[model samples]
Target: MTVTFSLPPALEARTPAEPRDGVRLMVSRGTSVSHHRFTELPHLLDPGDLLVVNNSGTLPAALQTLDGVLVHVSTSQPDGSWLVELRDTDIARTGLRLRVPEGSLTLLRPFTSRLWVAAADVPGDRVSYLTRHGRAIRYSYTDRDWPIETYQNVYATVPGSAEMPSAGRPLTGAVLAALAGQGVLVAPITLHTGVASAEVDEPPYPEWFRIPPSTAGLISHVRASGGRVIAVGTTVVRALETGTGEGWTDLVISPDHPIRVVDGLLTGLHEPRASHLMMLTAVAGEDALRESYTEALREHYLWHEFGDVHLLLR
Candidate 1:
């Protein structure tokens, strides 16, 4: 089925900061659209609604020129060396010139004008490296450090993501409290986002992921109890759907793929043609997804990680 989608200009990050949970939630069911706040998620669903959250923690994956040049490493090998995607090209490759304080450098390699590889010894764990050398990945619209914690949901645990599962970002301690107050059940699963790829093409590379059995059982229970399984982000939907067979995914979801689970989705507004939109199509179907997105564009819901949300209920 063909789905038409677009974003509203008003939703653009014309303003840098949006209050946590202050973004709008555009709820779509059939041809209808109901504007709501992200904080109102609990009240919008039934008591038995099962909320599935992605606990994949985010890394301050964007690096800058401290000594030389800044390259954002999206994926890392188990060996600690990383294949980072770089942005600037003014620096020489002979010596990695980054703005990072002295004694922070380890190894460096340039892959292309726009990408490179850099390594650091780092103290403690990988998280330390991120804290010391990296900043959160930002696109042209956003221009600030959103705090590693702001990029995360209250329930995030597993840490390996280059980006946050933003749809879940709207769910703060207050939102969770409200959900609990309303008797909604919340469960978590992990799916480390590798990198945010360009919408112009397919995914750039394979993303590694893992899901625990306890979360799987919670999903099964949610399904069996007639509680609508609501995925907090496209990452959660992808993790649950892809990992159900073996708790992992090397597969990409698209309209052609058949979905095995997830009845509802709470996700951010995506850029036009983003691979994520394809996954959303798989969940909401062509016609409805198209209508909802088209409406979002007309209504001016924001886009990107810090943007507003789109909740599609089937």
Candidate 2:
């Protein structure tokens, strides 16, 4: 099914919400839809529900060449090479190696096709190099560059994601405390997200993820007790549904697939025709997703990483 809509620039959020938890949330359950402040999420969920969050921390993935060209570090290969995208340079074909500034050399490869394999000559480690020189990846929708902290969720731990698992960004300490006080369970998994510029029809690339034994146990217990497992982001959904273990996953959740682990989703408001929309449709049903997106647009809800959220329940 083709789902398309025009996203006005005015509705794109340019900065993080003032209180983080001050963002708006649109909830969809079956045919019903409601709106509330993000802080009210604890009240919306039942006491026995389990909230699974992605704890993969965002990385400063943008690097600049001495010649003033920008390169985006998209993903890390298992062999220690990096998948990188050049901002403005053009390459005619694959199998070509180009020398970048700052002593880095990039080889055009077929992995992901759009990104080249990059290796830096001067680096203690990829993390160390990125920490010293890279900046957070931003798009034209963002008015200006913001600090990496602005993109991180309150529960971030394992530093790996190329981009923020943004659905959990509005979950502040106060909100988490409130949920815990009400007896809601929270679990953490890790899914290091790659760059987010996939073509509309392109499938997702493999990304590293780990579902800890503790988290896996909690999910099993929650399921046995009839508690809903609410995934805080698409990354968490991908990790849990794919299985409880550490590995690279290229699992794509779309309308053709049935989700087995995630009972609900709390995610950022995605634009129409986005790949994420396909995942949303799989969870919320196509008709419900359409209604929810229509309502979000009509209410002028924000979109993107620093935007409003949607809670879709079964």
Candidate 3:
């Protein structure tokens, strides 16, 4: 699958969309498409439809080294080592120690081409340490730094994701109330997302996810009752389609590996050649996805975490 358009820098959403209650939403069902405000999302769904959203919180995972290089903390390994990305450089040497604000990190070895295993320490818990010294991760598309609060969703509670589960960013309390009033079921699953390799467009690594039996039961009931199980982000899709209650997931959804659980998706616009486009293809079909992207680009829809969203229903 090839995406033929280039993303203009001006189309990048440099800041959070104002007033989270509404934003541009492109709804695609088959090869058909329509534009609507995100607040109209409830109207687009049937009474029994279920919207599965990821409640994993964003961590202020971007930290600066003593020399001012940025580090993206990806995950805490079970053995007390941390998996991190040295964002300022393309290569890392093992046994190199870099001094951080609170402490220092000693690179143990390579975890991936862009990530390394390291030992990290601070005054207290990792979260607390980050709260004091870290900032939200951003790329060149953003013009300036924004508060960490802007990187969070209204309902986020679990603190783990290196970046925000941004598809849920525009959902507000008002929207949730409206969905409930319209009899649309909303369920939460916790999926701790690791740092994204946006530069490389690499396949995602395993991340922790938890779908309680209650949400699992809701999925089963919705499917049996002729309702669509709509995932709010690729994170939720990965968690639900893995068909597990709680664990780390390395599942990669593509056209060849059919998606069994999700019937629809609400997600941000993915970049051309992103691994995420493969997952979107699984739910929306290749032609529909291609059409949607072409329309989005033509319509000047914003891209990235703070951008507008796309809804794909099967």
Candidate 4:
């Protein structure tokens, strides 16, 4: 989908999506479009459709250097270094030492245009260190700082994500109960999200993910029984497509890649140039994606992590 449009400031969801069920859900199947309240999600899916959710908790991973530059610790590398992004600053270079309240991180090399490999000298576990000294990462689209709880989904358990797996943000306890009563199934995947891409030119960094054996079996069973496998977020889509139990996934689900798992996606609206758009295209096709975004913009649907959601079903 090559369509693009201006994002007026009024349409950016600047705060938390509280009363998550109250948010709008735009459902798109092929070129057909419909709108409903997010609480109605249970009725949208058929019986036995499996909804795979990401349970990786959001981390307050944004810390400040001694010079006040923001460092977003994204993911930990296998070699014990961390992948991190330095926001709104240009002093980063190889061998650079970023000092924080807890410890210092020495930059090793460029992982991406905005991210660098850094060795952490913080005390205790990385999660605890970040918990004690860091705060939630926010982009310029947001109006003000919000608490970490606001970024987290109701079902998040494993703590690792630098940012929230926001597609599951609208899943309220009420909706979960309704889905269960409706005979829809739910499963879990752990994909710790890294920081989002701020530039269109940059691709996403590799993320750590784990797909439990039970969840994998459920996906196959549900599909064989004529049920759809619906991914709650792009994180779940990425994790499930890796075809492995646990590992770092570098898979970028563009139209070039085959959609091996998810038959539908429940996700938040993305920015104009966001790479997640490509993944949506892979699922819904280019024409459907093009038409859906055009309609979403015309209807004044909000965008961003705290915004309204888009359900792309095949």
Instruction: Report the number of the highest-TM-score candidate.
Output: 4
Greater-TM-score candidate between 3 and 4: 4
lDDT digits (tens) for residues 1-314 of candidate 1: 35644454556663433567888889988667789988888899888788888887888887765555666667665666666654655544645634454334443775444445557544655566777767777666666556677677667887888888878877878889999889898888777776664424445355566666777788788789888889898877777777653333667788788888888899988777677778888887777887787777777778877788889887
lDDT of 3 at 302: 93
Tens digit per residue, CA lDDT, model 4, 212-282: 99999999999899999999999999999888689989988899999988999999998887888889999
Best by lDDT: 4
Please provide, for model 2 over 118-232, each residue's C-alpha lDDT reduced to its tens digit, 9 standing for 90 to 100: 6556556666677778899998888899998988898999888888999999999999999999999999999999887733345678999999999999999999999999999
Candidate 4 worst ten-residue window by lDDT: 197-206
Q: Any runs in candidate 1 off by more than 4 Å, and if so which? A: 1-10, 14-18, 65-67, 89-125, 197-200, 244-248
lDDT of each model, Cα atoms only? 0.73, 0.85, 0.89, 0.90
* Clashing residue pair totals per candidate (backbone < 3 A): 12, 0, 0, 0
What is the lDDT for 35 in model 4? Answer: 94
What root-mean-square deviation over C-alphas does model 3 reach? 1.3
Candidate 4 yields a Cα-based lDDT of 0.90
- State the displacement of the C-alpha of residue 309, model 1, in Å, after optimal TM-score superposition: 0.7
Q: Which ten residues in a row have the lowest lDDT in candidate 1?
A: 197-206
| Reference-based lDDT, residue 40, model 1 | 86
